[model samples]
Target: MNVCGLDRWLRILVGIILVGLAAAGAIGVWGWIGLIPLLTGLFRWCPLYAIFGFQTCGLAEQKYGS
Candidate 1:
């Protein structure tokens, strides 16, 4: 939830592209790693962000348990 809308969307898009490429055999198995970003984006929780004490969620959202 700490992820901003745009950032989350971008991660989702990139993850989908990478995973799709992997599934299509267009890329190496490494592309499957895209799941990381995909899950993070969908969950709106980033470990790195937490470590860095960063948050992109709106004030209201954050206050409401984002």
Candidate 2:
């Protein structure tokens, strides 16, 4: 396993903020439900990604290659 840097942290933060704000909105959670995806998007470690082999975070191979 590896640790993530700034990009990963930023993604998590953005997810929390957007989801939190949406859940607080007047129109309510019908649309707020969409925030679930945003939340997952922010965190680079998605379960679906693991299944599909899709990772958006900084490249681990690139790090080691350097």
Candidate 3:
């Protein structure tokens, strides 16, 4: 299913965070909450991956063997 170098879901999550943080001044805590997703996306470390059993990064998976 996933063949990219980064998890698809994570990408979306990070995108959401980025948007929220960018709108932080208006959205309140939602904006601040955006950091978690932003960081996870930048680092490509999504906690949801374990629970969802999904990985989108083939390059890293091959290298790390996970």
Candidate 3 per-residue lDDT, tens place, 1-66, comes to 222354545665766866765675655655666666556656666677756876567766657744
What TM-score, over all chains together, does every model reach? 0.86, 0.41, 0.51
Report lDDT (Cα) of residue 29, candidate 1: 100
Against the true structure, whose TM-score is highest? 1
Give the poorly placed runs of model 1, Cα more than 4 Å off.
64-66
Clashes of each: 1, 0, 1
lDDT of 2 at 1: 13
Candidate rank order under TM-score: 1, 3, 2
lDDT of 1 at 27: 99
Error of 2 at 34 (Å): 7.0
**Tens-digit per-residue lDDT, 1-66, candidate 2:** 122455456656665666676777945666565455555644435566668775654576336621
Ordered by lDDT, highest first, the candidates read: 1, 3, 2
Residue lDDT tens for model 1, 1-66:
678678888889999999999999999999999998898899999999999999778888777854
